[model samples]
Target: MFSGLPQDYSSITVTNDGWWPDTDVADFQSQRSIPASIKTETVASALLMAIGEANAELAAYQSAQRAKGFSSAKDVTGPSAGGVNQLCAQYLKIIFARAKAELMGEITSAEREKANPGQQSEDTRDRLLAEASFAIRNIMGHPRVTVDLI
Candidate 1:
């Protein structure tokens, strides 16, 4: 319910649709195939958890910006101004979708989840997770490893 927080979704989505809509997940659906046991309500709960986690991760940057006396994010308008905003949207969509999939017992490769036994291969889940973290770093920027005493 926070103001200036992307309205929990953008103009492209119906105002009430959870994080990333089912329609928006065609790639995941085709690749993984949704498990029959995962109910709509369960997905909703997972989405809430995912949104909370994403918000927590972004809080530090939001706090820093507020301390600078920027009235709010809405006042800014430009491609560069939208960097954090764009990243924030992408972060929520991806993190939530992944969480929901995991909750549905679909943690394996999308191909594996598709029941493709022949394609079952070495576990690359860790690598994918690392890549996701790298993307997040692009959004958040690398931490300062040293401080100058100037």
Candidate 2:
């Protein structure tokens, strides 16, 4: 199905912190529809960076869960979505969204100009960034928006 692609197409797993499950680079590419032009190393680097940022962002939440007697994300009890733990899915969402956003930013101005050859109004990077933020908040059991009356 994927002919003429230079990618390895093998399942290369990216190891995350012990609290979080490992991520598959191939899955990320498939889910994001990342173009073959993007190198595997670039995608792997982005995923690693995203994993680090995600771990840091959710450090407090993880700590809270641990304090509550939960050892890892899988230990949390909740309804599963798509047969996967909710929190685990949300965590993956955060990592995948952030990695995709970073990869979108990797597209140079010239590459964009050549690809579009016209004005493109949509900013996918921004949307992905927002998605990452939303997933982070969801996993933390925080409201997407917290407003205080001024």
1-150 per-residue lDDT for model 1 (tens digits): 124532121112112223222222323333334433344444445545654555566667556656776444432332433345554444544554445434533323433445754334333444434544555565567642436798
lDDT of 2 by residue, 1-150 (tens): 446756555478998777787999888988776655677788899999999999998999999998999988887889886667989988888999888878765544424745652222247777888999999988888899998999
Model 2 residue 122 lDDT score: 41
Clash count of each predicted structure: 0, 0
Deviation in Å, model 1, residue 90 alpha carbon? 2.7
Q: Any residue pairs clashing in model 1, and if so which?
A: none
Clashing pairs in 2: none
Worst 10 residues of 1 by lDDT: 7-16
Clashes of 2: 0
Q: What TM-score against the true fold does each predicted structure earn?
A: 0.48, 0.82
Q: For candidate 1, give the lDDT.
A: 0.43
Off by over 4 Å in 2: 1-8, 81-83, 107-122
Could you tell me the lDDT of residue 100 within candidate 2? 81
